[model samples]
Target: MTTRPLPEAAFRVLLSLIFLVSGATHLLRPEAVAARLDGAPFAHVATALAPSTSLVLLAGVALLAGGLALLVGYRTRAAALGLIAVLVPITLTVQLAPEALGPLFKNVAILGGLVFFAAHGSEGYSADRALRLRRARRLVPALS
Candidate 1:
């Protein structure tokens, strides 16, 4: 019986795409998000959790970079972990509000994905695989 390699790369791609889209949405329309945020029960927490649009921009960059890294299976574990770092606080402080259970569910879903990706990175069809293949090729002896 053959054991198929896990679709870890695909998982990363999914996680990355989710984060990239969300980050882009927030970054592209900060005012809209900020407006929603201002009166939220979690507004004070959001202010401290995310700080400002500059922090939001940095979060956007991190999300984009981390997502791309995960999707490409390049340093996927690191990227997944980085995303978790960015997500955990927001998930707790903002998404977990009593009045925002719907958003909380979304955050939880992403958090679950991040945790999974952090533990298991792209095992199949990954940049790591390509690197391994290249290294193997170099190690093979050439017979003249």
Candidate 2:
């Protein structure tokens, strides 16, 4: 027998964990992240945002909010789009170097997945579905 694939919800959860951990890491260790970016070409952009720590922490909070929303299937499309917005600049600015090919590829792959999710939405087992179902149920009685 062929092996069964994981459920869509499980896949979503697994995928979302990446962002969750990344966000938490940024929030908990902004200094570490800042240190990594300290000498990067675009470090000035981050510095312009005020202290590097503040900017990094803010990015982390945004990631956390988007990741949490995606995880719960609440406005998943929007959440995915938000992640895409955040990832594009990062991939462009941080991962475009010769030695950064791996990170660049990874970000591109994640971006592709987010684009698909944004287009198709959270297929089922989500707050969006639950709300839709509830609304449909309410409408049915009036139609009847």
lDDT of each: 0.73, 0.80
TM-score of each: 0.79, 0.88
Query: What shift in Å separates residue 144 of candidate 1 from its native position after superposition?
Result: 14
Q: Ten residues in a row with the worst lDDT in model 2?
A: 1-10
Q: Tell me the lDDT of candidate 1.
A: 0.73
Which lDDT tens digits does candidate 2 get at residues 111-136?
A: 88788778878755878778888999
Regions more than 4 Å wrong, model 2: 1-6
TM-score of candidate 1 to 2 decimals:
0.79
Give me the overall lDDT of model 2. Answer: 0.80
Displacement of the residue 116 alpha carbon in candidate 1, Å: 1.6
Question: Model 1 over residues 38-129: C-alpha lDDT tens digits?
Answer: 65665677577555565567767887788777778777679889989878766665676677899889888888888876776656777866
Candidate 2 positional error at 144, Å: 2.1
| Candidate 2: residue 59 Cα off by (Å) | 1.0
